[model samples]
Target chain A: MFQGRIIDTKLRKLSIQDAEKFIASSDFGASIFFSGTVRNQNDNKSVIGITYDTHDALVIQSFEEIYNEANEKLEIKNKAVFIDHAKGYLNLGEISIIIAVATKHREEAYKLSRYIIEEIKKRSPIWKKEHYQNSESNWLKGNPLVNEKN
Target chain B: MKVKIELFGATRDFSDQNILELSLNNDSTIEDARIEIIKYLKKNFDGNKDFVRIVNTSAFSSENNNIVSDNYKIKNNEKIAIIPPIGGG
Candidate 1:
């Protein structure tokens, strides 16, 4: 069985104790967890805050698709996935996204965890608006690495 | 006839406006509307061949994958959504 969840919440304060408790309920032998936090710097500019805006319907649907695809392609036993990203204003050091996966073996767990993060970064329809110290804000488009237009 | 075009993602940023009101002939197809949109947006946007997807009602049509013909009638006040691919961490 593979469990997956996508939520919008303030996860910066996500505690390790709570994560341990969630992992404790599972019978898997190995667990992998990943957290994405708001970085204070971007392209040498000091980012004061970020606002994430998303097409709610499409984002949720795309996330479900990614989750399903990861489960089908990864060789894992009794996997569980949890993702939470904030929707409104997020300050520096706030947790942007959290992913945790569990499996019976370490290899599969590690591989699947990395794969999910990559796919989400590439495919998800979420967009971010970054605000700098000078009170300037711009809506950034897509993955900076893959989607940058030449 | 008039049609409402709703923009999403980077497409909205390119347009600098979220909604566009397009006046078209009664027999105009969706493709015609798109061409006019492309021409209007070309003044502000650099890329002419930028790929975009259209959502009419609930159906999704990609500019590369789907074909819109003259038989396609866009009703007045109908809303069409334009979506561009979005990527972020």
Candidate 2:
């Protein structure tokens, strides 16, 4: 079983606890959780916060595709996956994303966790705007989608 | 033909609008649309080459959720999305 969702900060926060519980099962012996937090600095600049914007529908689509790809590539049939990303402004140290996975073995759990995050970074239609200390902000440059092979 | 382009990321912030409407000749392709959009951005932003460069790297997607190539023809009143670079964890 797997689930993917975009968490709107205005409505509610992204909870690691929920993800942990969602991926927990008696049958799975290994569980892994990964969380991305808004850092206080980047590229020699002091960051106050970050605002994440997303193409809501497309982002979900990408998440589902990533999950399916992981299932196929990892060859792990029995698994539980939970993924949630924050939408809206987040302060430093706040969680931006969480990925939870449960599998029958530690190796599968670790590989699946790593694969999901890397794929999401390269594929998801989400953007980040960093707020700096001097009341300035800029949308960060990301992996180009235009040159993708059709 | 007229089509609506939904902006995202830097494009949306630079344009300050979620959607931008454009008029094109009949049966224009995505390449034509990309050129027109870049022209608009260049003119409005007073030759901000950096922004223009970013928009040039963007890809357009049809409402059916496919990243279309420049050769894909546009239909009248079609709603397309400008997908800029993606960075999510």
Q: Please give the DockQ score of every candidate, comma-separated.
A: 0.28, 0.62
Where in model 2 is the C-alpha error above 4 Å? Answer: A148-150
Deviating ranges (above 4 Å) for candidate 1:
A1-24, A143-150, B1-3, B13-17, B21-33, B39-79
* Candidate 1 CAPRI level: acceptable
A29-129 per-residue lDDT for model 2 (tens digits): 99999999999999999999999999888888998888888757889889899999999999999999999999999999999999999989988999999
| lDDT per residue (tens digit) for residues A1-150 in model 1 | 333333455544444444555565446888877888789998888999887765555556666677677656874436666655556677898776777777778888899879888887765666678899999987664542122222
Native contacts recovered by model 1: 0.37
Candidate 1 structure, TM-score to reference: 0.69
TM-score each candidate.
0.69, 0.96
Output the worst ten-in-a-row residue range by lDDT, candidate 2 chain A: A141-150
User: What are the root-mean-square deviations of the candidates from the true structure over C-alphas?
Assistant: 6.1, 1.9
- Which pairs of residues clash in candidate 2, taking residues 3 or more apart in a chain or in different chains? none
User: Reference contacts recovered by each candidate, as fractions?
Assistant: 0.37, 0.76
Interface RMSD of 1: 7.4
Best by lDDT: 2
